[model samples]
Target: MPSTRSQVDTLESGLPYDYTDDEFDPDYRESSEEEEDEVPKTMQRDRAKWIEDNVEDIEFLYRQLMRDGRSMFGDSFLQTGTINTFANFLYRNTTPFSEA
Candidate 1:
């Protein structure tokens, strides 16, 4: 075990913020656990909200891509023959509705 005189000196120096050797007990552990448990509920709610918003944005982008792609490619680019035609079709479909 460490010397009490060194521990007292360390405490007096205030080098460890609010912590000290004397404060370490079962009650401290229980309080820390309770604080930790409180965090997950808030984090889970934020995560769920973030996922919901992202899913909505993704769906919107998918629908927009489908609509604009069909318009630019005439819905029959896949059926067309020749590499040039397919290349032109691909190039034409490259421009998305959103600039950014």
Candidate 2:
């Protein structure tokens, strides 16, 4: 049976000790990769349009979530439901735009 110290040493050896290298830094990503990942103008326009269309609904939900602590709804209830709705809204909007 392995001793606890040896097991811990093995685990530590498998982990990265330094993250300063380029491979671990997002800002060090190659220029070509950045270019390939850039969103097209049309897609950007579509995303902007989608946001504009949903701005009112987003604002309304946000206001409800930002209400004073004395409101009838509990913080947990408001946070959970509002955040879930916002996430769902983003996911639904992304599907159409992303596939285009």
User: Against the true structure, what is each candidate's TM-score?
Assistant: 0.24, 0.36
Output the worst ten-in-a-row residue range by lDDT, candidate 2: 4-13
Model 2 C-alpha lDDT per residue in residues 1-100, reported as the tens digit of each score: 8666633423356865555477877678756734643455667666567667778777776676567432765555455445435534564455564532
Give the alpha-carbon lDDT of every model. 0.47, 0.56
| Model 1, residue pairs in steric clash | none
RMSD values for the candidates in order, in angstroms, are 20.6, 8.8
Model 2, runs deviating above 4 Å: 1-13, 23-39, 68-100
Residue-wise lDDT of candidate 1 within 1-100, one digit each (tens)?
8766633434556675455554676566434633432324434455445445556554565556566767998776444344333332333344242111
